[model samples]
Target: MKIRAAVLHSIGAERPFQDTRPLVIEELELDPPGDNEVLVQIKAAGLCHSDLSVIDGNRPRPVPMALGHEAAGIVKAVGSGVRDLKEGDHVVAVFVPSCGHCSPCAEGRPALCEPAAKTNNAGTLVSGEHRLHRDDGTPVNHHLGVSAFADHAVVSRDSLVRIDPALPFHHAALFGCAVLTGVGAVINSANIKAGQTVAVIGLGGVGLNSVLGAMVAGASEVIAFDLDDSKLALATELGASHAFNSKDPDCVEKIKALTKGGVDCAIEMAGSEKALEFAYLITRRGGTTVTGGLAHPEKKVAIQQVSLVAEERTLKGSYVGSCVPVRDVARYVSLFQQGKLPVDKLLTHTLTLDQINEGFERLAAGEAVRQVIEFN
Candidate 1:
C-alpha cells in the first residue's frame, strides 16, 4: 500500500527545521502485517523530544527512516498468530516491542526486552523486517518499530496496546510515550509515597506529566522547574505547589531551602546532562533521582561519587518510565478518564501532517507543550 510519511534521510540537520527540512514528506510503500503483526491506520501522532533527539542527532539511528513513534490508531488488520486484537480495535503504539520469551520480558520488564532493543537500534520491526520502502525499492527504516508519521504502519503486535474505543485518538496518542514515560517514572520508578516531597525537572509534556503523577501519588509538594516561565506557569496550574526557572542562579539553593535540603524524589525529563545533575542535586539525603531523558550517547553527567555513599542517594535511569506498557497504559488511561491525570491539558496544538515541520519547530523552540499531527 502507498502511504504518505515523513522520512528523515540524515541526522544533525541545522535548526530552523522549517528551512533545513530534515523530515521530508514522501510517498512510500507499506507492506502488509506479517505473523504476530498488525496493520494500523494512524489516527494521531505526537511530536515528542524522543523524536526531536533523533532529528538533532542526540540519539542516532539508521536513516532514511520514517519518524514518529508516539501514536494511536485503529487496527485495520491482524496477521496470523495474532488473536487478541481484531480489526477496528483502537490501540496505542509502544516504541518497544517485547518478545515475551526474552530475558527482560520474562522478568516482567518488557521495556528492556533484548530483542526489542536490538531491533529498535537496527530500525527494523521486532521480527527483523523492513516494511517501508521508496518507490525505487530503497528501504526506509522504521522508527522504534512504529514509523507512525505515516498514514498507516505495519508493526509487531507487541508494539501495540489495546485501548478503549471511546478514548480520543489525539489524547490516547500521548499514552504511548510522554504519559507513560513521565507518569511511569513517578509511579513505577520513584514510587513516591503519600506526603513525599517531589521535584519535577523540565516542564515539557513529559515533565509536566511527572508533576501530575506526583499529585496522583499523593506527594506533599510538587515543585516544577524549567527554563521557560510559561511552562512553569502551566505546571503550577496543573498542580505543582511551586515553580522555578532552573536557569535562576539561586534555583538550586531556593529549592533546597524550600524543602529543607531537597525533595524526596527528583525526576529529570529534560534530556540534558545538566538537568540530570540538577535533579541529583535536588534530591534529599537517601532520596531517589530518576532520569527518563534521552541525552546524546556521548553526553555524560558529573556527580560527586561519594554522595551516593554519604547521602545514600539512589540514581536510576528509567526507560519508558520503567513501564510495563500493557499495565501502565491502562492505568494511566483510567486516570485520564477519571479526570485526575488531565492529560488533555498537555496538548496545546493539533496540526495536519503537512504542518509537521512547523509543529516540530514549535516543539524545538519550546513554544508548544504537546503537538499532535491529526490524520483524517
Candidate 2:
C-alpha cells in the first residue's frame, strides 16, 4: 500500500525547521504486516520533544527514517499468529516494542527490553527488517519501530496496546509517551507518596504531566519550574501549589526555603545537564531526584559523590516513565477517565500534517504544551 509520511533525511540541519524543512512529506510504499505485526491507520499523533531531539541532533538516529513515535490508531489488519488483538481495535503505539522472551520483559520491565533497544537504535522492527520503501525501491528506516508520522504504519504486535474506543483519538495519543513518561516517573520511579513535597523542573508537556501526577498522588506541595511564564501559569492552573521561573538567580534558594531544605522528590523533564543538576540540588537529604529528560548522548552531569553516602540521596533515570505499557497505559487511561488526572487540559492545539514544522517550532520555543496531528 502507498501512504504519505514525513521523512527526515539528515540531522542538525540549520533550523527554522520550516525553512530547512527537516521533515518533508513523502509518499512511500508500505509492506504488509509480517508475522506478529499489525497494519494500522493512524488517527492522531503528538509532536514531542523526543522527535525534536532527532531533528536538532541532540538524540541521534539512523536517517532517511520516518519519524513519529507517539500516536494512536485503529488496527486495520493483524499478521499471522496474532490472537489477542484483531482488526478494528483501537491502539496506542509504544516506542519500545518488547519481545516477551527478553530478560527485561520477563522481569516486568518492558521499557528496558534489550532487543527493543537494539532494533530501535538500528532503525528496524524487532524482526530486523524495513517495511517501508521509496518509489525508487530505497529502504526507509523505522522510527522507534513506529514510523507513525505517516497516515499508516506497520509495527510489531508488541509495540501496540489496545485502548477504549470511546476515548478521543487525540487524547489517547498522549498515553503513548507524554502522559506515560511524566506520570509514570512520579509513581513508578520516584514512588511519590501523599504528604510529600515535590518540585518539577522544566514544565514542557511531560513536565506538566509530572505536576499533575504529583498532585494526584496527594503530594503536599507541588512546585513547578520553567523558563516560560505562560507555562508556569498553566502549571499553576493545573494544581501546582507553586510555580517559578527557573532562570531567576534566587529560584533554587527560594525553593529550598519554601520546602525547608528541599523537596522530597524533584523531577527533571528538560533535556539539559543544568536542569538535571538543578533537580538534584532541589531534592532534600534522603530524597530522590528523577530525570525523564533525554539529554545529548555525550552529555554528562557532575554531582558531589560524597552526598550519595552522607545524605542518602538517590538519583534515577526514568525511561518511558519506567512503565510496562501493557499495564500502565490502562491504569493511566482509567485515571484520566475518572477525572483524577485532567490530561485533556494539556492539549493546546491541533494541526494537520502540513503544519507539522510550525508545530515543532512552537515546541522548540516552549510556546505549546501538546500539539497533535489530527488526521482527517
Candidate 3:
C-alpha cells in the first residue's frame, strides 16, 4: 500500500527545522502485516522530544527512517496468529515491542525486553522486518517499531495496546509515550507515598505529567522546576505546590530551604545531564532521584559517589517510566477518564501532517506542551 510519510534521511539537521526541512515528506510503500502483526490507520500522532532527539542527533537511529512513535490509531487488519485484536479496535502504539519469552518480559519488565532492545536499536520491527520502502525500492527503517508519521503502519501486535473506542484519538496518543513515561516515573518508579515531598525538574509534557502524578499519589508538596516561567506557571496551575526556575542560581538553595533540606523524591525529565544533577541535588538524604530523560549517549552526569553510601541516596534510571505498558496504559487511561489525571490540559495544539515541521519547531522552542497531528 502507498502511504504518505515523513522520512528522515540523516541526523544532525541544522535548526530551524522549518528551514533545514530535515524530515522529507515522501510517498512510501507499506507492506502487509506479518504473523503477530497488525495494520493500523493512524488517527493521531504526537510530536515529542524523543522524536526531536533523533532530529537533533541526540539519540541516533538508522535512517532513512519513518519517524513518529507516540500515536493512537484504529486497527485495520490483523495478521496470522493474532486473535486478541481485530479490525475497528482502537489502540495506542508502544515504542518497545516485548516478546513475552524474553528474560525481561518473563520477569514482568516488558520495557526492557531483550529482543525489543535489539530490534529498536536496529530500527526494525520486533520480528526484525522492514515494512517500509521508498518508491525506488529503497528500504526505510521503522522508528521504534512504529513509524507512525504516516497514514498507515504495519507493527508487531506487542507494540499495540487496545484502548476504549470512546477515548479521543488525540488524547489517546499521549498515553503511548509522554503520559506513560511521565506519570509512570512517579507512580511506578518513585512510588511516592502519601505525604511525601516530591520535586519535578523539567516541565515539558512528561515533566508536567510527573507533577500531576505526584498530586495523584498524594504528595504533600509537589515542587516544579523549569527554565520557562510559562511552564512553571502551568505546572502550578496543574497542582504543583511551588514552582521555581532551574536557571536561578539560588534555585537549589530555595528548594532545600523550602523543604527543609530537599524533597523526598526528585524526578528528572529534562533529558539533560545538568537537569539530572539538579534533581540529585534537590533530593533529601536517603531520598530517591528518578530520571526518565533520554540524553545523548555520550553525555554523562557528575555526582559524588560517596553520597550513595553516606546519605543512602537512591538514583535510578527509568525507561518508559518502568511501565508495563499493557497494564499501565489501561490504568492511566482509567485515571484520565475519571478526571483524576486531567491529561487533557496537556494537549495544547493540534496540527495536520503538513505542519509537522512547524510543530517540531514549537516543540524545540518550548512553546507547546503536547502537539498532535490529527489525520482524517
Candidate 4:
C-alpha cells in the first residue's frame, strides 16, 4: 500500500534530529507483513523522549531512519498464522515486543528480552531487513522495528496490543510508551503499597505518571519534585500529596522530614546524575531507588558505595517499567476509559508532521507536556 511517511536520509553526528533537515515527506511503499507480522495504520503518534533521544544523538540508531515509536491506530492486515488479531481492530504498537522464547521473557523479565532487545541496536528488520522504501524502491532506515511515524507500518504480531475503540486516538498513543513506563514503574517495579511514602523526581510525562501510580497504589505521601511550577501543579492535579520545587533550598531535607527520615522509594525521571543522587539521599534504610529516565550517553550517575552498604538500599534500573505489552497496554486502556488515567488533561499539545521539528523544539525547551502529531 502507498502511504505518507517522513523519511530521514542522514543524521548529523552533532545532532541526529538535525538529519531531518533533508527530510522527505512523500508516498512510500510498505512491504506486506510476512508470517508472524501485522500491519497497522497509525492514527495518532506521540512525540516522546525516546524518539527525541534518537534525533538528538542521545540514542543513535543509524542514519535515514523513520522516527516516532509512541503511537496507536488500527490493524490493517494480519499475516498468515496470526490468530489473536484481525483487520480493523484498534491497537497500540509496542516498540519492544516480548518474544516469549527469549531468555528474559522466559525468565519473567520481558524488559530485558535479548533477541527482541537487540533489534533497535541492530537497526535491522526482525528478520534482519527493512520493511519500508521510497516510491522508487530505495531502502531507508527503520528507526525502531515498529516505526509508527509513518501513516502505516508493519510490525511483528507479538508487538501489537489490542485496545478499546472507545479510547481516544491521542490518549491511546501515550500508553504506547510514556504513560506505561511511568505507571508500570510504580505498580510493577516498586509495587508501592498503601501508606508507604514515595518521591517522584522530574515531573515530565514519565515522572508525573509515577506520581499518579503512587497515588493509585496508595502511597501515604506522594511528593512531586520538579523545577517547573506548572508541572508541579499538574502533578498535584494528578494526585500527588505533596509538591517540592526541584530547586528548593531544602528539597531533600523537606522530603526526609515528611517521611520521618526518608521516603520508602525514590523514582528518578530526570536522568541526571545529580537528580538521581538527590533521590538516593532521601531514601530510607532498605528503601528502593529506581532510575526511570533514559540519560544521554555523556551523562553518568554515580552511587556512593557507603550509602548502599549503610542504608541497605536497593538501586534498580527499570526499562519501560518491566511491561508486557499484551497485558499492560489493555489494562492502561481500561484505566483511561474509566478515567482512572488522567489522560485528557495530561496531554497538552498537538501539531502536524510538518511541524514535528517545532514539536521537538518545545520538548527540548521543556515547553510542552506531551506533544502529539496528528495525521488526517
lDDT string, candidate 4, 1-376, tens digits: 8878766555432323334343456677889998888898899989887877776667767767777788888998988889999999998877777778877899887767686778767765566667877777777666667777778988877777888898878888988888789989988888788999989998888888788778778898999998999899888888888888879878878777778899999999987788998889889989999888887778877778998988799999888888877788878777767777776677889877777776776777787878888777
* Candidate 4 CA-lDDT value: 0.80
TM-score for all models, in order of appearance: 0.99, 0.99, 0.99, 0.94
TM-score of 2: 0.99
Candidate 3 local lDDT, 208-279, one digit each (tens)? 999999999999999999999999999999999999888889988889899999999999999999999999
Flag regions of model 2 displaced more than 4 Å. none
Candidate 2 residue-wise lDDT, 145-172, digit = tens: 9998989999999999999999999999
Error of 3 at 63 (Å): 0.6
- The global Cα lDDT (0 to 1) of model 2 is 0.94
Displacement of the residue 120 alpha carbon in candidate 1, Å? 0.3
Return the clash pairs for model 4, or none.
17-55, 125-129
Q: CA lDDT, every prediction? A: 0.94, 0.94, 0.94, 0.80
Clashing pairs in 1: none
- Which of the two, 1 or 4, has more TM-score? 1
